[model samples]
Target chain A: MDSLGLYVLAAAVLFGVGVYGLIVSEHLMRKLFAINIMGNAIFILLVAASGPVEGAPDPVPQALVLTGIVIAVSATAFALALMVRLYQETGQATLSSRDEGDDG
Target chain B: MTAEALALIVFLPLLAACAAVAFPGRWLGWIVRIGLLPLPVLMLAPTLAVLDQNVIHLALAGHASPLGIEWRLDPLSLLMLWLNVGITVLISLHAGVSFRPDSDRGQRFWPLWLILFASMNALVLSADLFNLYVTLELVTLAAIGLIAVESKPAALRAGMRYLLLALMASLLYLLGVGLIYGQTGTLDLYLIAEQIEPGWLPVTAMALMIVGLLIKSAVFPLHAWLPAAHGNAPGPVSAILSAMVVKVSIYMIWRLWFWGAAGWDLATAANLMGLLGAAAIVYGSLAALVQDRLKMIVAYSTVAQLGYLMLLFPLASTLAFQAASYHLLSHGLAKAAMFLAAANILSSVGTDRLQRLAGVDQRRPLDVFALALGGVSILGLPPSGGFVAKWLFLEAAWHQQAWGWLVLVAAGGLLAAAYLFRVLGVICLHPRKRLNRRQHREIPNLASVAALILAVSAIAAGFFSAPVLSLISAGLPPGVTP
Candidate 1:
């Protein structure tokens, strides 16, 4: 496979793992990590869509990747803050509503 | 003038966000009010010249449409903007009094709220896919943060779950954007729409985008996140969350399929969505009727109201579009009024439980009036916005002879009335407060006034349908004209 195909496949794998973790993981921190993985996967896929450039890389996807990374970082940091605060207040790392089984 | 007014409308909210933090905590609440002073000038300016040929494209930073970021202001955007701004202003007015700047939640709430407003305003005006992704993320983060503002365990848990689901939705949406970009080499929605041929990639992208929007909008089967998040948030927070945030994705989905691209005969697809909507209306109303907490009831009703909008998908027509827009306005105002009033009652009485609520009307007459008036609209009573909108929907369905949809519309309205009257019945059965009557006096608060204004406006919407319809018609998006 070409490098572009490899990148796309890697993104797909990362995205699958992230979605799986996001849904199945009980802990909030793991979920946040899953979100990060998913975010990275999207970034990879976006960069891949930009195609390979030997002389000069496409600026559009590069610019988008930079902005996406910033947004992801800020979102991750905020989620982490929330996770820590929830753990402190309730002494539990998982969400209570899930344990309550109200989702059923 | 329209361009300047629109630009300021988007940016002034960002200014409010900064002022929320820059000013001293004591001054923050009132100071943000001062920042809102610029929006009223849009009222003074003449109406925007929306389109020459079904689109009024504006380029930012002196760049033209093909290269620089582009924005479009069609009727849908204009209508959404007007509704969004009206709700934001009312809620902000309520917030200034309800959340004292010195309060813990208030200090964190104002900045995020103003930023959410800016993001939503930008999202509606945006004409491109990549820009929409950024604004959507901003909106989701601000909304999640608002949900967690209370920092209580339930609120935190709700907020975390909301964040997870919203992130998932955004990823799905972004993947669609990626697919479209890979195929079309452009992120501008109109350009992408033009280049989109009925192929595997285009079809897959459309499906992904629609699924993402459905989840985010909490339409039916994907609706579990909404009740918990909206129900758990603080009052004005829930008001905007229920009224505006959920609508944005659905609005975008509408723009994509019906107006922008995906012009192929998705007749079966539209009918399927209509079926899901029917389920949402029935299930959501039943769920709302059984909800113990008042906010939970309102939140579930939001799911049902969203379903009402989805019916427009199957019955796509000028009348149906107009009906959906009117209903959206009607529901936004009425629901905001109800949630704000519920907040007043919950805070004053210390419980949102139906059995515990007694003499709330006596304590807060204006707030009760707000709830009742809002209930009237939700129930689709005459001389209210909901009634007019539903009537139009019924007429549209009948004209198309979509008999199933006609039945769903009638049944849904009846179910809405049933659930709404349940709350009204409870209110009328007001028991004497545990506290002495003299101890519980109605203290004046702007929240009640905000609620009252929204309630009055929802009723007023029924009368001004002609003008609103005309305004909406002015900026209708171009039909598929290859």
Candidate 2:
């Protein structure tokens, strides 16, 4: 099989695993990791989708993946800050809102 | 000149966001106020360049499409751009008076606020799929930053949920973009439009992208994150989030579908979107009727109003498109006004509970008036922009002989009225318990003034739909033949 086919399959698998983690994990940190895995998976797909030229990587999707990486870093930082604050204010980082009252 | 102005519209806010951090504490408000100086430049400049008989495009870093970033201007972008500018200005006006300059919330709010404005303008102009993805990220990040500014448990938790969902949504969108790239070998929107082959690749790409956008736009079932995020954020944050931020993603969905996917024969997809629109309208309105908190009611109402915009996907005519565009601007104004007015009540009463809002009309008469006027447009009554949009939507549905959409739109409006009046009803009744002075801080005149002007203009916009419609139809985006 071609490199593109392998990349696509890998992206699909990583995305599936990440989605499962997001749904099954109660902890926000685990969820964040799942999201990062999903993000990296897409970046890989983006790079592989371009089809390598004479063994040299195309700059556009690489540039895109680089940009995506920066965005992901900042987003991760912000989400972590939010998780920290939620933990501080309410003393838990779990996603189970049904057990708790909103106004509390 | 127009190109420079368009470029300035996107860049000026980014510069200000960077400058806001350096500009020191007490003068931060002044810096923010100065940051908005370019808005008048944006408003006064005629953004369209059709007079030159040239295809309007701007290449960032002096690079062309496919290999470089690109921005394109058309009537739909201009319409949404104008709406974004107007709503942002009014929201800023309210926010300017809402907090002290050195306060923690104010400090946390300005930079992110400026970034969101820039991101939205960039999103409006971007014509390349990868550039669109970047802009979407910026928009989502800045919105989460704003939502979490309160540092309260509720706001923080809501912000986290919003972040995760928004991240997932964008990843799905990016995957679809990747799939299309695998097929087409390009990310330029118009290029993709011209070359899209009708097949499973396009079909799967469309499904994934649509689901992604639907989740980001908070169309029902995915809407649980919205109320807590919107309702708990401080007033101005909620105002901008509800009014302009959500509309950004929806606008992207429309732009992509119409410009790139319209030729792909999306009959089944379009019908499904129409059904989702119906479900969102009915479900959201019912949920709004049952919400006890004032902001919660407005947040749910936003879900229903978004349904009206989604109707265009199914109807897929020039008139339906125009009606959807008009409704977006009108609903945005009305919702922002309503949220700010709710903020006023929350500020005065120390809580937003329905039971605590007794005699709010008597207490903050102007704010109540603002709320009621905003509700009038939300209900799509005559002599308002909402009414014009509803009438146009009905006409579009009639022409298509889609009798079901006609009933859905009307019923949604009726249900909207039911919930809106429920809040106003509380205002007219006597308070079950008297509010002590601590709970009865006077509502600021500036707050009500901002809300009143926006609400009235939403009504006034009704009378002037002719010019706006002509403008949008006049400059229909490239690849979308009228």
Candidate 3:
């Protein structure tokens, strides 16, 4: 396969994996990890696809992807904290409100 | 002066947030509150000056050719910036007084909030694609942190779920950016539009990007993370998340569709969006109707309000686009007011359940007024900006002969009204609860004032629609008549 084709396939695989993780993972933290990995995969695809403009990966998308990475991690960290809080207060990880005496 | 002012608009909060870390305990909350004061003034002054001017582009970092970042200001941006700063100030004010000095995780809240403000400013000001992505990430991170702060188990789990979804969305968006770069070899949106061919690559990139952003915007099927995350967050945090954070992703969606990939046939996409929007309107309203909790009802109401955004794609005209922007601004005001009113009721009852809020209006006249005003705005009743926005949106849809989209728009407003008044009905009914003396802490003056400002803005913005609409039309593309 051509380099572009190879990159596309890889991106597809990563996206698939991310989706799988989202579906399969029950723990909030694990789900976050899967999500971050998925994000990294996309960032790789973006940088790879924009290959070697002026003998360099295009700086603009790179900067954007970098920013995206930081955001991904920050959000992950925050969510982890929230998950821990949820576990401590309510002793559950699922999102349904039924257990808290909430109807619907 | 402009550069300094713009820089101050973004960085002052960042600096103060960082400085607040070492601040003494007794003053920590106050310090955080003080840190957010300058931004609204900074943004407000420029907005007035740029009232007639359409596009204000500021070049920064001065390195030529794709290296430097550009800050573009437009009426849409100014409105967003003002709301971000204004709402943050009010949220901070409420947080300062309502939170116990010793409670809430010390100085952390202010820093994250300031960072969120900075990122929001950057998101609105951003001129190019990369900057938009970066700013979006910043917003997501800060928002997640805010959600997790409750330190309750559910908050942690919900926050984590939100984070995961956000990460997935960001990754997907990045992948799309990569494809666009490969095809065009440029990151500047304007430059990309010039070089991009009408071909498979750009189309693929657009699809991927839309999917990613749809998740972030919490549009329909991808919106699983929002209701829980927004509902579970602290009151002020919920206000900010609902009022402005989600709108940033929607703004980026607009930037991409309108400016970057302007010529792509959006008919199918528009119809799909319209369908999902319709579903969200009905589903969100039905969901809100059944929600026993106040915040969840409001959170679902957000889903319905968000459906209004999709109307732009179907009715893609200057008028339609202007109406969408109007709805965005109006919804920001009304939703913020709604959340603040909900916060007031929660404080009064030590809970946010609707049934518990019985007799609340009778007991707290201020909260009653706030809820009533907020309800009127959300329902798109007369003299409110929500009404003006719906009127304009309906007008544009009627002009296009897009009858299906028109019906959905009207139906969404009615759904919004149904949900908004459902809670109002509870308050007005005066159910069987005696007010516990201990639960009554005087609602902070700032929260009420903040809600009032937004409520007034929602009503007053109708009068200024002509100017704002004109501002949005500046430099827009004209019809390509043969």
Best by lDDT: 2
Query: For residues A20-89, could you state the per-residue lDDT of candidate 2 as single tens digits?
Result: 9999998999999999999988998888766664687667777778888998898889888888888998
Best-to-worst order by TM-score is 2, 1, 3
DockQ of each: 0.49, 0.58, 0.50
TM-scores of the models, in the given order? 0.94, 0.96, 0.91
Best model number under DockQ = 2
B254-372 per-residue lDDT for model 3 (tens digits): 77876787776778887887788788778888888898899888888898889888878767787787778888877887788777777777776778887777778766767668667
Task: State each candidate's clash count.
Answer: 0, 1, 14
Task: State candidate 1's DockQ.
Answer: 0.49
lDDT of each: 0.82, 0.83, 0.75
Q: What TM-score does the predicted chain A of each candidate obtain versus native chain A?
A: 0.87, 0.87, 0.83
Clashing pairs in 1: none
lDDT of 1 by residue, B1-482 (tens): 76677777888888878888887578886667765656665633423465334446678766864447788877678788888888988887777767667787788888888899889989998998888888988999999998888776777888887888888888888888878877887888877767877788888998888898899999999998999888878888999998999999889888888655646778888889998889999999999999878888888999998998899788888788888889999999999999999888777766677655556667777888999999889878899998889898898888888888889889988888888788877776755545444445353488799999999999999998997887666655556221
Per-residue error (Å), model 2, residue B316: 1.4
Q: What is the per-candidate TM-score for chain B?
A: 0.95, 0.96, 0.93
Model no. 3, DockQ: 0.50
lDDT of 2 by residue, B8-59 (tens): 7888888888888887588887788777766766645545364333247778
